[model samples]
Target chain A: EPEVTQTPSHQVTQMGQEVILRCVPISNHLYFYWYRQILGQKVEFLVSFYNNEISEKSEIFDDQFSVERPDGSNFTLKIRSTKLEDSAMYFCASSKDSNQPQHFGDGTRLSIL
Target chain B: AQRVTQPEKLLSVFKGAPVELKCNYSYSGSPELFWYVQYSRQRLQLLLRHISRESIKGFTADLNKGETSFHLKKPFAQEEDSAMYYCAVLGPGTYKYIFGTGTRLKVLA
Candidate 1:
């Protein structure tokens, strides 16, 4: 089965540094999403993308955060300046359609210190 | 606002015993509920959804609108069933899924 794939299974970066989390969503998926889970907390939605535009974004997705499908297979999330509270496991997901169930990647663990 | 709550943080069951992982939600619009499972060292994956009204791997869930619940259940527990379960809720017209804190199920042999 084709599955979403994320790069740098674990990442550690200093505060105030820029970081990019990469994901390769399942081929042929039309909708993409980004979610994050802080340690010991419920997963939280960040943003959703489709048709080369952002469909919806939570308040947590602020000016510092941006997402792009720079290429056919790669979806990247960029944080301009990292904060301590930004540490979490970031999961990328894709679905054939908006209303269908999403298939998630193994996740990229970002640690800011 | 939409939210899902998994009251139990951990649950233990013996092999061949029945098990139920409780899940509750609060949503104003029509809710789409799902149960996702993650085994150790594996990615999170969908186990079942309320819309299907069918069983997968001997597991089933009933969406009770009155109680605002969509709990997952299995008639017979197996060791392979041990994993972390998360209840998720999505509001109408959106794909942003909200997940619960999750419950870890342990099946003892």
Candidate 2:
């Protein structure tokens, strides 16, 4: 079965640095999303992307965060300056279309010092 | 806002024993309910959804409108069934999915 794939299973970064997480969603998926889970916390929605633009975002997706579908297959999330609290497991998911069931990747574990 | 609750953080049962992983949701509107599972060292994957109404791998969940519950259950446990189980709810008016803290089910062999 086709599944969402994320790059760099784990990442180590320093405070004030920049990091870009990458994901290649299922080829036919139209809706993409980013969710973060802090250790021992609930999974929080960050943003949703459709038609190559942001469809919706939560308060957590502030100025420092940006997403781009630079190509047909890749969806990327960039954080301008990482904060210590920004460290968490960032998951990328995609659904065939809006309101459809989403498929999630294993998740990229990020740690900031 | 909506929330899903899976009260038990851990549950253990021996093989061939019946199992029930409780899940409850707080949403006024009729919403979609799903049960997702993640095995150790594996990615999170869909275990089953309420809509199908068909058992998958002997696992079934009934959406109880009166009680606002969508608990996952199985007739008999198997060692392969050990994993992290999460109950999720998608509100009718919103696309954001609210997931329960999760219940880790361990089917002892």
Candidate 3:
């Protein structure tokens, strides 16, 4: 079965530096989403993308955060400036449609110093 | 407020014993409920969906509208069933999912 793959399974970045988390969703999936789980916290939704535009986003997805489907298969989340609070396990997911069960990637563990 | 709640942070069950993971939610609209499992380092896998009403891996969950709960249950547990389970709810017209804190299931042999 096709699965969403994320790059740099683990990332360590210095504070105030820009970091982009990359994900290649399932080939035929149409909807993409980004979620983060801080240590000891539940997974929190960041944003959802479809049709080359953001369909919805949470308050956590502020000006500092941006998402782009740079290509047909790649969906990337960029954090303009890393903060200590940004350290978390970032998961990328995709689904065939809006109401379908989402398939998630292994996740990228981002550690901001 | 739209939220998903899993009161138990951890649950333990002996092999061949019955298992139940509780999940409760508060949503204004018609919500979609799903049970996702993560085995060790593996990614989250869709275990069951209330809408499907089908059993997967011997597990089943029935969504109760009046109680506002969707609890995952397995008639018999196995060692392989040890994993972290998360309950999530998606509200109508909302593309984002509200996830619960997650319950870590430890099936002892």
Number of the predicted model whose TM-score against the real structure is largest:
3
lDDT of 3 by residue, A1-113 (tens): 78899998999999999999999999999999999999999999999999999999999999999999998889999999999999999999999999998999999999999
What tens digits encode model 2's per-residue C-alpha lDDT throughout A1-104? 99999988999999999999999999999999999989988788899999988988889999999999999899999999999999999999999977788899
lDDT of residue A87 for candidate 2: 93
TM-score to true structure, per model: 0.98, 0.97, 0.99
lDDT of 1 at B76: 97
Candidate 2 local Cα displacement, residue A99, angstroms: 2.0
What is residue A86's positional error in candidate 2, in angstroms? Answer: 1.2
Residue B5 in model 2: shift from native, Å? 0.6
Among these predicted structures, which one has the highest lDDT?
A: 3
DockQ of each: 0.91, 0.68, 0.94
Model 1: residue A32 alpha-carbon error in angstroms: 0.4
Please report how far candidate 2 places residue A42 from its true position, in Å: 2.0
Better of 1 and 3 by DockQ: 3
Ranking by DockQ: 3, 1, 2
lDDT of 2 by residue, B10-95 (tens): 99999999999999889887899999898997877888888888888899999999999999999999999999998988777565
lDDT of 3 by residue, B1-109 (tens): 8889999999999999999999999999789999999999999999998999999999999999999999999999999999999999988888888999999999999
Candidate 3 CAPRI-style tier: high
Model 2: runs farther than 4 Å from truth? none
Better of 1 and 2 by lDDT: 1
Q: Order of candidates by TM-score, top first? A: 3, 1, 2
